[model samples]
Target chain A: GDTEPHARLPTCYPYGNLNVDELVQRLAQAGLADARVDDSKEGLVITLANDDVVIQINEFATHIISANSSLREKLRDILLECLGSF
Target chain B: LIMKNNSMKILGVNEAWGELGIVSHQLRFTERIEVEHIGPVQALTSSLHTLLSQKLGTTQVQVVSEYQLSVADSVVINIQDDNDDPGKNILLSWTHQDEALGSKLLEIIKANFKK
Candidate 1:
């Protein structure tokens, strides 16, 4: 009873929906990070540090698509570009 | 950086060790920020600095009020850390006021560093 269980995060988006490969490529293109994309159950986490802003993107597919319509569009656009890159 | 910038919020916390002699300390959020917030956008910084000053017995200063520094929106304050040089700088954008306190880590240092 002494120890608190843990934190429950209700992320609006889930990572599984994103095209993991293209998402990694898009992040690299944006200069947000540098690393090979790895798709796992743990999901992908993006961390941004622009002087003062600290943004983290962790979500499920439906929530990500619903919460940020524009970001969803960006994801689609980036995926299309990745297709052309190959 | 803005010497008059009260766009920061802060509080103080006293840390110490237990039976294991584990010492803890920092004056972050040393003061509660109760000023009616205009919203969680950008004005929170000013309210924080105002509250922090009264509690910590320190003054809030910004670089913009004086010689311009690269960081133009950070609230600067002095704390009693006789253990360290007390010359470290903390830059907060939209983070908690206690952020600056974290800069003065004293768990391990206090053992070796003499105040």
Candidate 2:
């Protein structure tokens, strides 16, 4: 019997007033592909989707990341690596 | 697969409004809260002062500044004080993301308004 996979709870981190394009590029550089951006009247919406992780950046300078529960540590490492570039 | 959002808005005694938005994934949480309709400026300030007095352990509520109260473990309530038109002023935000702490802060917010 297959066991249930743990849920990857999303977490949001505010990184000051960060430019959306810069973040997308950073993630893309980190091997996270399929980065998309939407600049609308409301604000900028950016999403970076891959098999291991999915990142959503809202207008409020908050980055919400969702990944597999088991990959949480790896995701953090990647995120910190990307953020450290800033 | 964790994506959920819950929001609430509370109207104060004098038409002041407070809105709370919670985005949860599994045990983690992210929230944004804003308060408008601050009743009277003096009254609201006094209320904030009193509310800020209720502390828990080493985590006492901190008055980060003249108009900001960092309550609970993670919630930060900032009051936008308007002298001439206090009622029109507001509490801009109390936001953070954490496990367990976020829900605890929500309770504190609800309790304050109930007073």
- Residue pairs with colliding backbones in model 2 are A9-B25, B16-B37, B17-B36
Best by TM-score: 2
The DockQ-derived docking category for candidate 1 is incorrect
Which tens-of-lDDT digit does each residue in A28-68 have in candidate 2? 66666586777655555555455433344443434343323
lDDT of 1 by residue, B1-115 (tens): 1112445333222211132232221111111111222233233334334433333333333423221111113333222212233322222221122233322211112222223
Model 1 CA lDDT for position B21: 31
lDDT of 1 by residue, A59-85 (tens): 322111111224333543453343321
Q: Any runs in candidate 1 off by more than 4 Å, and if so which? A: A1-16, A34-42, A51-86, B1-115
Q: What is the Cα-based lDDT of residue A63 in candidate 2?
A: 37
DockQ of each: 0.01, 0.04
Error of 1 at B87 (Å): 26
TM-score, candidate number 2: 0.35
Lowest summed lDDT over 10 consecutive residues: which window, candidate 1 chain B? Answer: B25-34
lDDT (0 to 1) per candidate: 0.29, 0.43
Best-matching candidate per DockQ: 2
